[model samples]
Target: MAAAKDAIKNRERLLASVILVSLICGWVAGLFKHHSDIAGFLKQALPGAVRFDSSEDNIYTGLTHAQSESKKAGFVAVRSAHGYAGPVTVAVGLDANGKIVNAVIVRHTELPAFFRRVTDNGFPGRFKGKDCSDQFEIGGDVDSVTGATVSLAALAEAVRVACSDIATGRLGLLPIVKNKPAIQFGLPEILLILLIVTGFAAYGKKLPANTYMKWVVLAASLVFIGFVLKRPISLININSLLVGYWPRWQNNVYWYLLLAVLLLPVILRGKTPYCSNICPFGATQEILIKLGGSRRQLPEKCSQFFKVLQRSLAWIAVMCALVFRNPAIITYEVSATFFTIIGQNWQFVLLALVLILSLFIARPWCNCLCPVRAVSDYVRLLRRGFTR
Candidate 1:
């Protein structure tokens, strides 16, 4: 019976793990799944037009045309730049006398509303008469939009690149960069789904996996990386995405869905998949555990200090998290301001040390702290005496 119980427990953990992984993965997939739709919606909401050419009777064309009057009047390229998130390509048409003609967003990797900074309110029109030596930095000759400085910088960079090309007479040779797409339901997604399904089949009815959920998890993860990672890849960015764009119209739909998936593993599977498999942020923290595996020395006196600090921090964060109705703060505990701003260099080292030492101490971070796990643990309590 003891052996059977252990097997059962293991199965629960597997299911729980799959659930946590699926939630995170699915979130990302939704983004990629609807990326084009999102872009199109934005375009319809706010519009910008692109102009081609130095002046009247002349134009730079997307596709080369045959026997066209404008095609024959290709003029010298004098591009403009603005800083942007990644890179932005803008085509600025100048008159024969280097007078500004028109500007348009040719190509860029910035988010929606972000591109507007390039062609907003005659902003691009401002470049018409200025020589190449005019100042265009933010708050200078050109104004930077709020909440889009990086994207602005990237656009500026591209403009600079175009100008360099013009100087080298390579404007005609500018190569366009387009986004590449991933398979909608590729083999990886299929395999992951199969693995999840097998777990559910073996344990769904009797143990946690009685209802196979592994496949669902596998699918979510693939989508997360493909879609979510593209726009909200970084820790801060993802956290922001969850908060800023979490579907909140009808009774906080996105937040509730995330809560259900994140907490499901512990309740049904008896596993900590959130920490074990799905969380990229947690994965980064675990590096410290691996690094300090061999040479970890315990300080008996200071042990209580770390515990107190961790616990106090957790409660404070939990309270704030509870009030804000945001779960990101819980994740932030493991990666607080110290690690985020001041102690960044040491983050990798500390995470490695803690993760490796956990092999001996049974998840020191999860036990002493880890806001997300704490939430899961809290949610699990409500489900006591139940088996699902």
Candidate 2:
């Protein structure tokens, strides 16, 4: 009892230490390194409202880029709400007469391409000096960002707030930064910390084997799986349907849409549906241990050879998808001919037989073969605040 208590106390201390260090590092990295003369100008332009990121030195590059056209269209915005990932502070340009000018994306808080819905093909440029009447309207005149409407709404709000500041003489904007990471604020850092912290929370400590908790976790897991695997009605799964192209590339919207509607209702009906009750992949190893009143430790030959190879392949699949940007490779094997060939290959069938035996020995597919769940595990770790 005392050892367990001591361990818990140690965990608490470790959590605190990790959080503190992360915050300090993120704050220092976010500020005080890169200089922003335009940020200084924007600071002067709108004190206590928004400013340039002190990290990357690119505030004024926006103004310089727009200088040639400022006389033609002119832009004026003290702040921008339509951010890349989250809300951001941006220097909106307008014509001399207070009309909106070029919408220079001053800075954003998300990774480079996550918000491709907003940033792709210069989507933000469309808003340059857009009339106040134009907001979230659906049409080619205003293209829809695939999976990120929330970002757009927030961005619009940010811009409105900044404009209000200026209109009411509560703010002004004359100065700006030089280049890159156009805006800086505390919220983004704090949010990043919380996100990392959530990762540990999602990791979850080993809990007592209470039946109730087991049911809850199982149900929660199933519900999560159902939602993610649901076919594409929106942008979240657009990648599934897209094969890629140029000049008005297209998506196989109908194929995925049909699968979603048909498969969802049917899957919800079965005792375990596609995932296997208790998660075949989840419960395989446990079942194997108690198979038909006969159990034995896996032979070293089987464990050492297959287990290591499976883990290595899984890692390669995940890294290729994550680092090399190959979702097609990441999500599934993705070849009709490959699927056909899988059954015919003798080695593959033998592997399947071993997996089935593993169902008696352990969760064979989940431990070694499944790729989606592996990625989910990583996201779950981050969500639970377990990086510490």
Candidate 3:
């Protein structure tokens, strides 16, 4: 009994340590990424425009005006809007006719790769010539970045808010339209629905030799869910849900489908087929283990340690997400690295290490570091407790 109590105490200390380290790392990373001060950001966002010293004539809320030295270049409003991760500030240049001359991102907390995708795909450029009259709906007037839907939507919202404020409050022009909802069903949504239905039908029932069926589902997940759709269940998605950044269900049916497939089974059956049968990364690791022809297991004590470590990592990740209110801060998973091929160098290195290690050990990442596994295990524990 004394040894058990000591083990529990040690586990609690380890958990506390992990949480502290994760929070510190997240704060430091945020500061490092956003080291370019607001002044520098404004300079890049509004070229050739000097900050106006006089604050007497400012009309729009949460904005500062800047104009060129020549006075013929018109004015720009530097404003900010709430984004997925945090505020996304931008400089919206306005012509004499109240039309947008140009817009530039001043600062944002979106993931760097997704932000790059938005810029590279000319997302900001689309704001040019748009005014208060234009409805900034994602599908109607603005095309969102394919993989970075939330980031793109945030950018669009920032531009729209800035432009509307300038046009209505300062320019004395009424907005031509109110905000419109962006909602539509497409191929991705259909595919997700089909996949979820198939998973529930196959795994939710008791059938003989279901192992072959699980293999088929795994292959489909690796191909369709991972490569084609590129929408693997990520820690980011989980964090977003926790932080109330739920994607609009009308436009984000795929997200809804994924969440349902992951959650519904766990709620009903105390486990999800996603981890064991449908996770693309798990499928890849299994394939590698088979091909490498090495099956090894850690000692019982080591395995127990790893299980504790896994739970601790998951706890730390959740705490970081809550503290930072930024999903990107907890993105230690390798799903994006494999599917999107766009992630930090450390993430790539980690992915490589995990794959190499999987040759000798079965599902090493799932056993040692997967937040999803930790969550599943917790849910199962709760179910067992309630049953007892």
- Estimate the overall C-alpha local distance difference test score of candidate 1: 0.42
The candidate 1 region of ten consecutive residues with least summed lDDT is 41-50
Per-residue CA lDDT of model 1 for 1-388, tens digit only, reads 9999878767756754654454455445534432122232222211231223233422232212333443322223323332212224465543333333444455443434434544564444555555433434556655775545555654544443443344234233334332223323444344444433443343333336432344334334434522233211222223334433332223223333334435566677665444444443443334445554642434666655765555456445434333343333333333332222212345556666655556665456655655555445544743542454
TM-score of candidate 2 against the unseen true structure: 0.36
The lDDT per prediction is 0.42, 0.38, 0.70
CA error at residue 202 for candidate 2, angstroms: 16
Please identify which of the two predictions, 1 or 3, would achieve the higher lDDT against the true structure: 3
Residue-pair clashes per prediction, in order, are 43, 56, 0
The estimated TM-scores of all candidates read 0.33, 0.36, 0.71
**Candidate 3 structure, TM-score to reference:** 0.71
* Model 3: per-residue Cα lDDT over 286-322, one tens digit each: 8888888987877789899989988778777766765
lDDT of 2 at 69: 43
Query: Between candidates 1 and 2, which one is better according to TM-score?
Result: 2
Off by over 4 Å in 1: 1-244, 247-261, 267-312, 318-343, 385-388
Candidate 1 scores a C-alpha RMSD against the true structure in Å of: 15.8
155-208 per-residue lDDT for model 2 (tens digits): 555554444433333124432222223333343233333322332233343445
Poorest 10 consecutive residues by lDDT, candidate 3: 54-63
Which residue runs of candidate 2 sit more than 4 Å off their true CA positions?
1-35, 39-75, 80-86, 96-98, 133-142, 162-388
